[model samples]
Target: QQQVRQSPQSLTVWEGGTTVLTCSYEDSTFNYFPWYQQFPGEGPALLISILSVSDKKEDGRFTTFFNKREKKLSLHIIDSQPGDSATYFCAASAGSNNRIFFGDGTQLVVKP
Candidate 1:
């Protein structure tokens, strides 16, 4: 039960709009939470992360709201821009094997 899943294989939003992506996990043992952002031909990079101890995390235009009790989380992009157009992945790990379970990914396009 170490799988994480995301919804909406793709999304499009106008510039300066807000976009929300959802994620859920099958394992309740998960503790470490991280979100990765990827651009064309580029490797995923850690965007923002939160531990199970915390409920919310924010960085610049990115925010992650996590619900440890429900084993679910979501990412909210505020004032989305063309630059934010990319594949966003939600990931999680149980602090072992150094491996992170990733979502299928949500491709977001911010039109200018």
Candidate 2:
């Protein structure tokens, strides 16, 4: 996808609650989608993402949902903790170049 857009500039979730972040892409040619997390004063890191062949992929308390028909994807975090507060970026990549296009990022705040 050439352009990825994420919703809700920022959000706040309570500890042990669930947090959701959404993203939409313009192009369907893109194959790989990834979600990244970044904390203040630190570089973005891979939180939980895969090659994403299936509609849903999950790891621990994190889950990603992809809707091929809607051209949208979302990240769901269950049992959210204060430490989980950070900025998340949704991205897509395609072709042999492996160039990834990222969304503007959503700031998540997990309250204690």
Model 2 / residue 9 / CA error / Å: 0.9
In Å, residue 55's CA in model 1 sits off its true spot by 0.5
Tens-place lDDT per residue, model 1, 5-108, is 99789999999999999999988778988999999999999999999999999899999999977889999999999999999999999996778999999999
The candidate that wins on TM-score is 1
Where does candidate 1 stray beyond 4 Å? none
User: Cα lDDT of model 2 overall?
Assistant: 0.89
Q: Which residue window of length 10 is worst by lDDT in model 1?
A: 1-10
- Pairs of residues clashing in candidate 2: none
Candidate 2 local Cα displacement, residue 95, angstroms: 3.4
TM-score versus the correct structure, for each prediction: 0.95, 0.93
Give per-residue lDDT, candidate 1, residue 67: 92
**Which runs of model 2 end up more than 4 angstroms from their true locations?**
none
Clashes of 2: 0
